[model samples]
Target: MSNFDIRDLLDHAAAAEPAQPAPASADEKEPRLSPLAERMAALPVRPTYSPVIITGAARLADIAVVLATGYAALAIYIAPNHGYPLSYLGLLPVFALATVAALQAAGLYHIGAMRSVLTQAFRVLASWSVIFLLALAALFFTKTSEEYSRVWLLGWYVSGLAGLFLVRLALGLAVTRLTRAGRLDRRTVIVGGGEAAERLIEALAAQRDTGVRICGFFDDRSDDRSPNVLAGYPKLGTVDDLVTFARRTQVDLIIFTLPITAEARILQMLRKLWVLPTDIRLAAHMSQLRLRPRAYSYIGSVPVLDVFDKPIADWDLVLKWLFDKLVGTILLVLLSPLLLLTALAVKLDSPGPVLFRQKRYGFNNELIEVFKFRSMYVDQSDATAARLVTKGDPRVTRVGRIIRKTSLDELPQLFNVVLKGNLSLVGPRPHALHAKAENRLYDKVVDGYFARHKVKPGITGWAQINGWRGETDTEEKIQRRVEHDLFYIENWSVLFDLVILLKTPLALLKSENAY
Candidate 1:
């Protein structure tokens, strides 16, 4: 106020401004949250290294193997009085290997089964016990009865069974603890903001061992249109932000809580998010769609309409794998002489290795090397499968034609099922990487074509027995095969697999469709 210079007086007046008026009131101000709370409120989130189906599957597999091996070893060691000094050590490894292999096939080592620890443990105990009894029966049949004492066998069985149970219990406890800590959970994000999203969140949170953890809601609306906070969760950003967040975060699931009536929006969202390696589900709880109850899966009694489900889920795949390896091994052993003759014939007829290896698309679009009995001449073997194998082709050797037409050439794939873990005994038959029908890719031709690959492709399948085998030159032929594949996937059971396996020999007799 006392400034003497004219310039100084003017500068003071210029620098002065009306105060910001203290931002009205706290309630009127926008909600400010702490970084951690902000993150939680804005969640439909995942951690960087979240657990997945493969990880859970592997853990269960390891647990089963460890229990099987450790129990056998411990039992042998504990029963010192009934066996020859060190000769029984060899039997321990053999039993462990056989029991583990059998258990794996028995569906005792599946990730879904692992969740029900008691049930899985009982299954493990039953499988190993049966295998042990079978070993005894084999010894008796071979008249090697006096080699081991009965006392040793009984003691071993008791100790091994107890040890198996204890190991499973410990594993179950550890898995539960980790799951509670959010280490072994599926991180989920809600795609809509409003009342429906709120209720879905509440329902999901109420379930114990449900395995879904909601991160946050994403909606493209202003504050008045979509509340800043809905059902205790904040509206993080927009649909664009959801895409960005999904990429940045460790999200494993995206649940669209929007109504199913928004078909165009749903399809658009799917097109945008489908390429991500996460699951995309459309919440159909609020919808009036009159769908089958089986079409809906529950989360603590809260119904969610399934847009997509896990393929080859639970213990079915485990048993299928087991049957393949077991039967494949037996066949390999029994048919050794025939295999030798085939090998000799192939070597004499063609200038190539006894087994011809070619790359084919396996489960999940993974490239796998398939084995054949060298049906094509060395110079003409197509590595990329650019051309289809037609009847009476020049590339086919004299013996090759006979073996291929007779379906004997595919016997080598039994080894693929056993050793490579690429093929199964019963399922959809795999097509070539460049396989086409009606001038379009097999995947492109069908709506959920790739979904058939949820389980491993088989050497012989339901389609093969139903006359859908061999060259799929016509659209009708391929469509029939795909239909059979889908039917198999939808109604898969161990008995269904067994029936297909039994019918395979009969199917092979009708090789009219074979190339």
Candidate 2:
């Protein structure tokens, strides 16, 4: 729609595309993904802390200071013994809440503010003073001045301020250490080189503590056009290389220094870059084109077009991980009897291993071994999934048929969801390495196939619940599955996951395609 923003348009454009580039075919001399993997492996993997986690910790720290000091002040000065009554206890919470609200309103919890001791102290003192002023106002209105001691209120205010400074001093030292180690800062990689990138880099650097640490540049131009090194950072590689690099390590932000007017290059870059789970920003500072102010978010003073954002990121990632761990463990415990019975069934029916471990594409297109109860005979086990198992297929044992039909064979992947930390309880289903439909590899049959991996694969998924489970015997079947997968990814939430999970039992009843 014309009214939609550029980011929304770019995001949907790739998914709507009929076809996109696929990895090199088997006939090619060198495979595409192997080299990408090798290149990624060569790069050092660095730790990255989520901004949400950092900001949340800062908020908790503020609340802890106010609440702890409020209690201490109450205990020290006529807290209960001479409080005129037990009424002062109620006011402690109000005072603590007021101080925290004041500090939040002052924006003292922002990443930029957290990095600076002077900034935090000045802001904290101002906010604390304002709260105390308000508390005095409340006390005057309530005529409770005669009831509580002035020393108590003053001590609470001063002690709260001191607590804030002490806590933040420790946080400040930690921030400095994290900054030095590239943990706290957003590890950024500029996608374009030249004066535009140099200008952007200089602008960020000028701000000193912009909270973004430039990792380097990734440009498509030749060395003459775009030098190997620019603005004191090396040109790591091209946009294609950037994707591989991101898979290897944590790349928090991807900024395109190229002006917005370079639509073709921007779109091209986006086609490849959209698959990454990182913030993608198109720097629009030099572009003559402008949209409403709300359309852009700034990095320091540089204006940037908000493009694709990583899905299930920050707190959502944390929450999903927690949910998987908690729920998966419970489910695993509750179903231990069933799992044991199934394992015994598989062992008795077929002389193969009780569990099957097949490599499947996981989050960020990385291979994660998925566990399943062995559903095929030992000699005929299709590890690569090169052939589709059909109805009355000879390889399918009697127990395998029942488990596969009932979907109990996938229960062991609870380990993947719980212990391994690679799979989610509900997400796009990860496919075997050589999974194919209609004799064509999934990547070749569908455009943007790997895009489904933007989130961790799950044992159950939107596609599975929507009649897209079981065999993918045709290209159309896989396409529909991928479509459902992308839809689930775009609209994911805890509630959505719960709904899909609840509907799974009913969906499993119609196992006509399960074989």
Candidate 3:
């Protein structure tokens, strides 16, 4: 495994908030910063969480498709030429369908299956063999045996099995590389302190292939309850800090080292953190009570039971991301002329840059610069986004008005899709960094707000096309938008992404959400 360290980030954090150096005494006056110094001081903030779930999911799907197709194709090719038995070709499709059904039914396509490629390969082989045998039995019973050649059938079956094994052998290494690069990983946070958290960290470190990167930890008590460092990982903050961290850090799993006996406390903590988009698991190491073997998931030998799970994980995410980049790139290339014209128009109609980059909250509540065409006058632009663009706001330039209304101002964000790799072509729309609904942070208002970050924010999202875009000045608007975003996250796919993309042009024409 390649060495990875987050020390630079930590050092930057420490320097940014330079410790006051425990005062000579609580009585001595503290050094004061000048107004400029105060203004320049910035708090430690983690980058907005980036979505890996989709990427991981897509990769898994690709692997499954490759193995299934390769196996079926090999089987058809090697089936000893059954005397021009074109009827054997019919069996190919049947075998392929059966293989897919069996694979899905056996759960061999799941993200968790990546943990044990050998075990999973065996399951796939078993399932595929069963399906193939069933198909052969059906053919025989139907008196279709004359349509096949025994030699061809034997060759096909043998080759097909070989192909399955080969695909898995190749995939095992690829998946390991992806997971190690932090591409296919579960963001985890330690929930207990001292020895428990330390042991957990050491174990996770020992098995980097487990794909569980510690985002940090949250302990209720301060120095007394937790140590300054647990297995070289600091206490990022408190449980409250964990909530904020979950919002700001790219986290997916939260492992609670506290036993099941702390049921009341665990439940209370879950009530607070469970609302975020993360898998909450109770680390079952210290528990005297044992659950059924099937009831728990293990990292090496340490067992954990599920509490909450971030939805649309692994291969699902990978497929969605692939679709976004591929389709988004094609669209951008095709529409470059239109994008250029829009930029020229913005420049001629307004005394500002053609593109307006706004700080928006991205995955994990980290700030990202989202691109748009300048719609408002240079001086009147709202940096904090406290004021919503109105129907007749004088600050909006002539070009801004047209682009904003027609949704052309968003055209520049395609580069954002290609460049920063922040937004996708389809998914949930990312809101402003401080977007408020009902005078509360959107995260505070919406349960599992960060969950939406499980996938990339899109240029045109499921919510926007469904009439949930534009100025969210009212609580209902934000609530409805969140609802749609959540819905998209829960039921995501490449086909779904394609559907959203195809429908977006028509949705843009409607302009119900556009100001």
Candidate 4:
């Protein structure tokens, strides 16, 4: 693999034209910018909470089509003569599962497959044929072939094929439309502006169907060493500037072109880049050392080593969202009485709204309004938490002290989990954007503090259950809290979330740090 020719990575015929002279930097001169780039820049650099994975909407759509076709086939053959078969109803889910799995195995759902209408139709036919054959073989093996109607089976098979084809046709058109609208392309940036970066750019440009849009490059080198323009791409800024640029732009992937031999420099750059919620890849096309194929992920045949992947990507995101909504709704219903009573007590004890909304650093460092039952006098409310709520603070109302201590004040955030979908039931606890410790911001107290926000903020997190909750009067307190948050992100799992949730109530009972 190390000896793989670099020339094979690029399509010489389609290579990008020599880059034009470098335009003035955005900061140095008024440069004309694309409307999309301009809008992204003007937007506040908040943590974007978008599902980074391919929207499962398409997958779900395909599943629905499979299910619908199966039922339609059953109805077409059975309903006219003997009515719907009760046994067939149970078989629908199994068939749908099998069909989806087959399609997945055949790579029909891949982004590349969606680019061509003909290719999608062909794959659909092939996958559907496999499902039909499997179903027939199962029937034959079970000796149940004689029990079912041959006419019904034949009609169902024909109808299912047509249905699958039509669905793929519609999906192909939709993909085309979305791609044209710039909704389907991955926003990519190159990290080094040298020969390696140029080669990767040319490779990506040749495969336009790969859906990678190389916006620009970010390098620390000077123009004389690393030209301002590389293979029709300009250097946006330096390595540090890449962080700010990434925050401003909807950058999805950052490809590092620096050779792997520069381990110290690469590690230093990664320390800065990993904080942003984006995939970081080290280009390996020019590397001398070869590793197993499993070690590298490909971006259109060009091998790159994965440095850091955005956590809970693709289908995992969908699963987590479903978990949050299902549990959040159940919790809201089960605890409605306590929630109502808490609202009333807060209303009677304090002259403020039942719920208090405070701006907190949410997923990707975006400011989200986290809801909580009001626990302070209306006039003395510290929205920013500029003053940490100390024990026996006079500003805390009578009911506020009890709620804050017991964590009942946090109940309203269930709405944030179920309704707004911003906060998860388990993750790092969201802190007020201006939350401080000894007059220093939490980020200043800890390295990679912003990295914790890569996942959504939660009502109860690892930090709280680990006894790192409450006032961060000392720097160590905040440091420990961040430490726990990062650990939770790295070691996240559904079982882990359940464990945290189970431990949270007991932790609350202790309330050693609660104000």
Candidate 5:
């Protein structure tokens, strides 16, 4: 029988009591009645994982193995007959890329495929064989086959294949161990409860190897309409409670079990949830309507329609973090003299600390202390920025004015990027916790204002480079900044970051809105 059929029976038999009594208010210590659940059901839900870095590490390991295997084979052959030309080494990178590409195309990198050692070993062998044939063909077409040692070429092919197989086998074993311990599993939650949600839960349960643990379910309906327990899963609370739960628990994926035909309902739900930094999918397995083949992604055999994807996910997050550290560190060293001079200037010009630490909204709406070179007089400084900095403000010191206008005061935040791992070199600019525009909180001015915190705040951002930097005195200024920040998050790439970095200096030269 199917997994759902089995669960259906088990859940029905075990439905004697509610999973855990509905959460009670602080005044009442004991578990409360369904009234609490009903109250939460009326409230709005918010839309919201950690980036899966394991896959990125695996990819890097495979690439290293490929390179090492090629070089090892070449060395083995060269040791017998003096040395070969350095030109042969140039092919190592090309070979590595080709093998990885081939493996990816073969779906060997898919989580399901990586679960089995035998399956992965076969895929690795096939990918390496394809790379070898392509390399041989290229040599033949160029009529340069005889230039290199035939023994080395053949030996490298065999050694590379063996190396790839061994690597996959080891990884497969490690992943199995991690999965059993729940360390490698993705923490997922289901939205909507009832038959559709139960079906999705059952489908997920069948694929034990997929490593997705369904935490619970969230539905807008009261417990009477939507049972407190469905298919062995508890109804955590209503959609509103889901937002708080997701934030507190670090939820990775939020899967909506509602059908696609409920477009208005789905859209409304999305409006609430999109502000979160999590993968949101609409379960499409139970839908009678068919979509384009490319439109659906599978969680095991069950299909899900992609709604919104977390920005800079998985391997992309890894690459961005590495880029931030490497580039941020280099910039720190190169600008050390200027940093020291600025410190001295700030110290001499103002009778206060050189650095200013202000609490700003960071990734996932958490607060982080952001560092900056202090530019205002100690007595007159506005740590919370309750009052906006205006043109020729009396609070500014002599050196502070120069640094603030020239954007040199932001240099200390580079250390934030390199050290804290909270800031990226390129992302939305972090706003002070109580930062205001036009005498109003930013969240009041713009809907989904917190969405910008989905990614780590940056030292420099797309908005800043596009002339949205400096004082956000007007509501429109903050709104425009949020719009730009959203755009950058939606279309992030390593190349895009470099482009923004390149244009920042020119943008800072204008100082259009700086006081």
Candidate 6:
């Protein structure tokens, strides 16, 4: 296993150059993963939540508290005044949003804010008071104070403060509980070894509440140069193996301890590691190239340069997930009749099940069973998709031919998005493991093909909408598809997803390439 050569990623990048992976370990007969490596890959990991999710939750809770308190004050105080201006109702959401903005500016939204209950309380109180003061000053300057009730304002402010305290207390307890359960910690691994790695480790250790838990090291150098163990963490494997480990375990962060001056090695490492969907950072504590303060982001007290971050992560992931579930359910319900008709067509046209399940690569190289309306004969079904359906292919049934062209065959992938949650409604299309273009595997025919896997695959995608869908029989066809996929990933947004989805039906009308 140690003697086997690693895959030369550079060759693939150099122009879709043909290459083969190193031979498998003799006993295990595994090409990429060995027996021990497979076991290590399956090592249990504690749950890790995004720090943004925690802070965002705090902001939402704070906003809710303020809004609810203001409304309650309005209901209680309005009777005494016989009736205050109806315009005051419009001020509620604005005030709540402003309060959250103030808290965020005061750093109350930081993940570490709840680490100390007293400190959090003080910060929240100070920021909330300041926002109220500002609001009062604004009302006075605008000469609108006469229209509003001082008594109502006082009640609102005081009650809002009390509500904030309660919410913060609950938030603090939740953070404390997560901390105790070790669910808040990010499982991290250092990408280099030796003195640089030690310095980075020590710097991280000096800081509190960083939530960074070092797992091990990975360096390509021999044991003499980069020791097998450094600073109490074992050298897990080489950078080549780090990719596999990250894919299997879903590691959160990969910090490179190599000096910034090692540009060549850093670039090389990135060429290989960029395929994994993890935050890749460079430790800059020892670097002399100083940038502006805003250019650097800190994890605890350790400043680092962010090279690459997990895409559609944190809040964006939350939004996308919510979009998928809510919109997916509505679409599924609305399209139920169409889906049933398609199922019946397949059932009557062939003596096979209505849904065809096939394993395809998903996020981070995980295999997922994608459901589609069975389009081909049962005896002639291509589960591995070794041979892609071609125009007028003999294997396709009468029902399959029409559905495949119209994309009705793919409607069942909504089950994948809504139920399985492994796929997005709009992203790169997933392909079979052995899917080929020009008789070569896609990875061999397109440079940086796996980089598309950085995000979850979709039923419909930027490529599909832009005329890259359907058969990928030639290298040019697959290459163009991958290029569009990468472009969508780089410029992903909710709006972009919606635009692609809107164009999907139109794209299906022009099925020149589809089998």
**Top candidate (TM-score):** 6
Q: How well does model 5 score by local distance difference test?
A: 0.79
What is candidate 4's local distance difference test score?
Answer: 0.78
TM-score of each predicted structure versus truth: 0.57, 0.87, 0.67, 0.83, 0.82, 0.90
lDDT of 2 at 57: 78
Q: Can you tell me which runs of candidate 1 are displaced by over 4 Å?
A: 1-172, 176-183, 187-209, 213-254, 263-281, 284-303
All models, RMSD in angstroms: 16.5, 7.7, 7.5, 7.1, 6.3, 6.7
Write the number of the candidate with greater lDDT, choosing between 1 and 3: 3
Better of 3 and 4 by TM-score: 4
On lDDT, the stronger of 1 and 2 is: 2
**1-515, model 4: which lDDT tens digit per residue?**
01111132223313332222224575642233332333334544323223225435556666777678768877777778878777677667776787778778877776667668798788888887888788889999999878777776677667777877776777678766666666666678898877888888888878756667676677787756578567866555677766766655567889999999999999999988888888899999999999999998988888999998888777677788888999889999999999999999999886769999898888877778989999998899999888898988999999998999999999999999999999999999898867889998788888888999889989998999989887789999999998998898888888888899989999998886888
Q: Given candidate 4, what's the lDDT at residue 17? A: 24
Cand. 2 TM to true fold: 0.87
Quote the lDDT for 481 in model 1: 91
Candidate 6 stretches greater than 4 Å from native: 1-23, 26-39, 79-81, 84-87, 133-146
The lowest-lDDT stretch of 10 consecutive residues in candidate 1 is: 15-24
> lDDT of all predictions, in order shown?
0.68, 0.81, 0.69, 0.78, 0.79, 0.83
Residue 32, model 4: Cα distance from true site in angstroms: 19
Clashing pairs in 5: 47-272, 47-273, 48-276
Candidate 3 TM-score, C-alpha based: 0.67
Per-residue lDDT, model 1, residue 186, is: 66
Error of 6 at 194 (Å): 0.9
lDDT of 1 by residue, 1-515 (tens): 01122233224334322111122245531223323323433444323223344444554554455456545544565445544345565576676667667666866554345556788677877876887789889889989867766766776677666766665666566665565556656667788877788888888777675677665567765646466556655555666555545544465677888888888987776655543445677787787786888887765566776565545544654566678889878877887788888989999886769998878767655578888898888889887666777777798889988888788888888888889889987878878777777667776677556566656788888899998887777778888898898788778888888899889889888888776
TM-score of 1: 0.57
